[model samples]
Target: MSDVFERYERQYCELSSNLSRKCTAAAALNGEQKKQMISIVKTGIDEAESLIRKMDLEARSLQPNVKAVLLAKLREYKSDLNNVKTEVKRLSSGGNYLSARDDLLESGMADTLTASNDQKARLMMSTERLNHTGDRIKESRKTMLETEELGVSILQDLHQQRQSLLHAHNTLHGVDDNIGRSKRILTSMSRRMNRNKWIIGFIIAILIIAIALILYFKLK
Candidate 1:
């Protein structure tokens, strides 16, 4: 679902960008060139409309929270598309208006009106470009923040793993210490048992000698 949405969304952005560039190019063109650009713009508008429909359909099929976000984005994109269409229509009309007024070129008022219209068109184009730049900046900031959050989460996971490893290392050291102590205690016990055996053998030898001496004296 998300993949489809992103595909359509990416295509729409590209289409819109193409249309914007064509529109800007139209401003500097005339005669056959301008006519061809206008044709391209019309076709792009149709493609844009189709993409919008696909996006809207995918958005509606999504979960409530996600759907809401997509719908809002769709609404904004629709407005931007409308703005592009309006600008194209304005350009076409401006061209026709200039041609129609060719006969009145000698009139001062006609010249002033023409200059004013041209200035207004340029101003509108500048404003549109400015708005697009602002939107791009906002998107960049959002991406940066999301990246930072992911980085922080990864760091937290690493810290927890490090702590667990440290605990295991300490436990092993303690076990080694206990094993050494137990070995020393067993060695001390073995030495005491050997000394007791020697004492018992010496006492038995003295008893045998005294018994023999008493027997000999009785016989004599």
Candidate 2:
């Protein structure tokens, strides 16, 4: 049972580390960055699910109290990953880029895009929440380091660990929201910049046409 617990604990730590990486990536990722994040998330989810299945089997063979705590923690991790999956799907849908370059040009999208920087500020706040959660998880792990027993005390320790996991779960959700908002703002800004480029090009073309007309009339 101790061996199985050790194995499960290692796997759980790996999953948590992967989740933190994903959250960090999501906070700063652009469209291409998002693709990279998606890959990381997918790999992490697959590994976590596999570990969870093994944990379930091992749990069935172990003592009830130990098995119960481990199973509960595993379920929480699974739920957090599933939430991340949903967020990834929403991000990949590209619904946020509804306003094209032409639309931006016609609608003064630069101003609109500039105004959305507030969302960036909000995202920064969300990153703070993630950082706080990471700190909490580290603190919680420190308590486990001092533990010398594996009886009922282990159950209480696991409960504290679960609370730390919940913090991580909440942090990930905050990251997902921030990422979605940031993606929309970025896509809008890109479209606005493209529109400005087109406008400048058109102005240059008009100037060239005016020069040509002037030369023709003067020579005639």
Candidate 3:
């Protein structure tokens, strides 16, 4: 367990540093390199987060001292994951700027040098705004899809839970019926036993009276 936690911690630390460096160098990165770096960081972040979550679960059953250490490691990994996520977001947002810059520089328009500062500034601003808007629209669509999937999953889980509860309720109801039948049977048997006891007592009383009368006649 300790080894596992240590490994995850080391991996997270390494990924965090790599992502930070990548973000710092993002302005110099070409489109392909940026995409590759983003992919690496995203994958590493997911792995690190998963490892920490596993560590959390394993720590629950460990001794106090070991559990504390594991928990601390988990926190460190989580922090690193957050840092990596921030770097990724930075890179993603900068991607549009990089693309627009590349487009403008590669256009080789002869008038670009003669263009006024105000005109260039306006063009740059318009390009960036359009890119950012497009990115936001894509993100919104992604979020909507994810939310719909989550809702479906929740409904399925609720349906399963309801089925389980209904089954349990039916089982308890059957048990109650069995108990009622047993109680009725017991009451009927008890009444029959009491009636039989009374009949036996009356027969014994009559037998005793007859014997007493015969004995008294012989003596007189």
Compute the lDDT of residue 180 as modeled in candidate 1. Answer: 94
Q: Give each prediction's root-mean-square deviation over alpha carbons.
A: 15.8, 37.9, 7.6
Clashing pairs in 1: none
TM-score, predicted candidate 1 vs. hidden true structure: 0.46
Clashes of each: 0, 0, 0
- The candidate with the higher lDDT, 2 or 3, is 3
- Where in model 1 is the C-alpha error above 4 Å? 101-220
Clashing pairs in 3: none
Candidate 3, after superposition: displacement of residue 173 in Å? 6.8
All candidates in order of TM-score, best leading:
3, 1, 2
lDDT of 2 at 103: 33
Error of 3 at 99 (Å): 2.7
> Per-residue lDDT of 70-172 in model 3, one digit per residue for the tens?
7786787677667667767777767766666666566565575554454567567967787788689779958975875576567657766887999999999
RMSD of 2: 37.9
User: In model 3, where is the ten-residue run with the lowest total lDDT?
Assistant: 110-119
Q: What is the TM-score (0 to 1) of candidate 2?
A: 0.39
- True-vs-predicted CA distance for residue 217, candidate 1, Å: 97
At residue 126, give the lDDT of candidate 3: 65
> Cα lDDT of model 3 overall?
0.72
On residues 70-113, what C-alpha lDDT tens digit does candidate 1 reach at each position?
99999999999999988987887676555445423433354777
